[model samples]
Target chain A: MLLILPIIVPMLTAALLLLVRHRGVQRWMAFLGSMTHLGCGIALFRLVQSEGIQVLQSGSWKAPFGIVLVADTLTTLLVIAVGVVGAATTAFGFAGVDPRRESGGYHSLFMVLLMGVSGAFLTGDLFNLYVWFEVMLVASFVLMALHRTKEQVRAAFTYVTLNLLASAILLTALGLLYGQSGTLNMADLSRQWSTAGPPPLHLPLALLFLTAFGIKAALFPWFFWLPASYHTPPAAISAIFAGLLTKVGVYSMIRVFTLLFQRVSPGIYTLILVLSAVTMVVGVTCALTQRDFRRVLSFNLVGHIGYTTLGLGLLSPVALAGSLLYVLHHIVAITNLYLVGGIFLRVRRTTDFASLGSLYRTHPYVALLSLVPIFALAGVPPLSGFIAKIVLVQASFAQGVYWAGGIALFVGLLSVLSMARLWDESFWKDAPDGVDKASPTWKQLLPIGALTLLSLGISVGAEPLLDMTSRVAGDLLEPSAYVRAVLDGDG
Target chain B: MELLFALTAGVLYASGLYLMLRRRLAQLIIGLGLLTNGTNILIFTSGGLTRTNAPVLAADALETTEPFADPVPQALILTAIVIGFGVLAFSLVLAHQVHRSSGTDDVGDRQ
Candidate 1:
């Protein structure tokens, strides 16, 4: 029962939002629903922390037969992050989004998007994950095109087409897996693979999974759709997308690689190591050339995705823990950055760096607030990204993958350069003659402040979070406990 | 019979990929349809083909005898079709809107 509530609450909220026509009421209800979602996520996280992995077989049909919702440490942590980001996005949307767009089922679609994300995080069945991906995809498609501007329509076209292709590829992978293993349950497949060694077709199937999830995660070569579309939506929509969407892909990759593949192919991990290095360098490099605030952030988002995968590539307990920590840090910092981008967009009527300036002179507090996430993203000390990056670098060095560790350090330097450039252009320069320098309303600042504090909380509480992630990483590295819980352990 | 189904699926996949590469929105959407259909058939054939035996069990028997079609792929295909339909409907509407807004169906020229 507790396993399904994170998904169910949003599902119900979306339905209720659709029924109500009043925009104001719908917004309030969505906020309430998201808060409730955050509460449920915390409760679920606590339960899992105290009492091992929690598994609920849907309708009591038994595992390897019925669909299951499993909440291990990794899943619960992401759920809590999703809950936090969702609540912040909704709060920001209230003041950030246009009234007309808000009336166009914004709240409803937002809830559905949350539901889909939660479902993706919680599902234990492969096909069920695909369904949740579709649910999220559909809602995101409508939300991106809600304004229906020409640029938006064009961007949505590219986004939708590419994502649908990824989905088809994912389905093909699922079909092949089921045909090869005679089962779609993740634990069952893992058990079979471990007992008999991987099948002859394992390499192709692994590559297929890599391509499908890699595209979603916005890895090096397949990340074009993300930057092309992410900046086109309202900042609130893009913030949520920035916060949670690609991370879901990383989560799936982690889940599939750690749980199902389990070091069967050293070749795959080496390949991932190479890809992640390129991803990190390429993402930050591209971010440097972008003049649009959100576009710069979008490209950086792609680069940071590489860091999460870096841990998975190493496949050590410390590395996996570092990856999880990176994910948690990235979600808060990136989403807050985009929310600040929204405030900038509202003030300047444009996000282009060339046309916007002097925010520091007019709104020192806003600039100060924005600096936290910006520098945090750059891996400055005493922030969440710093600790996460340090762990990954330490793990890579310990494993003697010196080249990859070197690349990680190199990318961290590039990230600092790019973020500092963004600060210099957007906040410190003289204001263009026609642009507005009016301060954002207090409501707009509230969510940003909350997220900034949350990022700070991650920094201050780094030791405990790192400890939890290491434990989670331990469970990921050894899935016997997870498999047993799913197959035989009580809900 | 299995060979024929596999060939059909391969053909669908080939045509789908070909059409999806075109610049036109209509062809792209049609290509998406073919791609999804190709996936469905691949799933069907991969599950092993059965010409005569349905998945239905006899009234007196506790389990069906050998040579029956696998019900799992059929169920998976059903779910795939429904989801494909929803995505298809959405893409079609979005394409129409893209056309109306841009006054062009060529995606390459839209940017």
Candidate 2:
């Protein structure tokens, strides 16, 4: 029951929210549901730590036959991060979203989206993963188009088309893999390939999965859909997408590359590293030219995905740990940044940075709250991003991959420059002529304050989190424990 | 017999991609539908064709024996087809909305 609660809680919440008629009651119920999800996630985190990796085979059909839900350290940590983002974004949406859009089933779709995220993280079956991806895609499609603006309709075309293509590719990969291995269970496939050597179609299958996930993760040359569509939605919706959606793709990539491929291909690693370097360069450079507030963050989100992928490419324990930590830090900081953008949109009625300014002088508290995510995202010292970058660089240098390490450091500098530019234009510059400015209500500031405190908490608790991620990296490197736990427990 | 299925899938995929590459919204939806159907056929062929055996167990038997058709791919295809149908329906509605809103079906013209 505990194993399924993460997905079930949101499912039930969305259903109940849909049934409720009163707007005020619906808002409270959504908040209650998300908080319950957070509680379940924390409980699961505690359970995983005490019990090691937890696997639940649905319907008692055994591991290779039935679907399973596995919550290893990596999955649990991501679940917790999703929980934090979900709760914060839910509150932000309540305050920031227009009443008409909010009434158009926003709360329910948001819960369904969280349910999909949890399902994607926990499922140990490849086909089930595809199903969950569809769930997320459907919910997000409606959420993006809820406002029904001309720009949104245009962006939704690209978003829906490209995402559907990716899903189709993912389905093809699953079908082919099942044909090759005769099983869709991830652990079973990993065990078969690890013990029996690479299957005949292994390379093609791996590349297929890469292509599918690459589009989802917004990797270089495949990321055009993200920046085009991400800025079309409300800030609350964009905040959640910026926080968790692409990370799901990264999570799957890390899971597949580590478990199925076993990190044995030096050529593949080099390819990923080079691709990641190029992605970082391209994303940050594009971000530099963006004038819209959320567009800049959207492009920067793409660049940061490159950093996490770089960690995956390095494949060392330290590097993978860094990758996981980088994902966690990005989730918190980026979501907070978007919430701050939401406040700007709420008060000033626009997210175009050129027409926006003087928040540092006008609302010192908002500026102060904004600085935490800005500096954290910029990899300033003692923050979570800094520690994660240091670990990745240290791992790359230790492995004698100096060029990738150099690019990582160089990209960090570029990210800082882009973020500084954002700061100067949005907060530090003088207010534009004849723009109405209204102070944000307390409800709007509350979630931002909570998320800022959460980011600070991650910084302060970095030591234990790093230690936990290091253990996760160790398990991912030698996945025998994961396989044994899933396969053997069935008997 | 297997070769026929393979050829049909290939044609579906080819035509689907060709149509999808066009700028019109209606063609895009049609292409997506064909593409998913092609994938379904691909899975069915790749799972191996056994015309005489259907993998159904006898009343007294606990499990079916060899030479029986594989049921897993059929199950997978069923799920995929359902999901594909729903998604295609959603896309159709969205494309109609786009056409009505923008007064054009050419996706390229929107930008």
Candidate of highest DockQ: 1
- Can you write out model 1's per-residue Cα lDDT over A337-429, one digit (the tens) per residue? 999988887888788998777888878889989989999999999899999999999999999999989999999999999999999889998
In model 1, the Cα lDDT at residue A24 comes to 72
Candidate 2: misplaced stretches above 4 Å?
A263-265
Q: In candidate 1, list every pair of residues with a backbone clash.
A: none
- Compared with the true structure, what per-residue lDDT tens digits does model 2 show for residues A178-206? 87888888899889987777668877887
Per-model chain B TM-scores are: 0.95, 0.95
> Taking the candidates one at a time, how many backbone clashes does each contain?
0, 0
Runs of candidate 1 exceeding 4 Å displacement: none
**Deviation from native of the Cα of residue A173 in model 2, angstroms:** 0.8
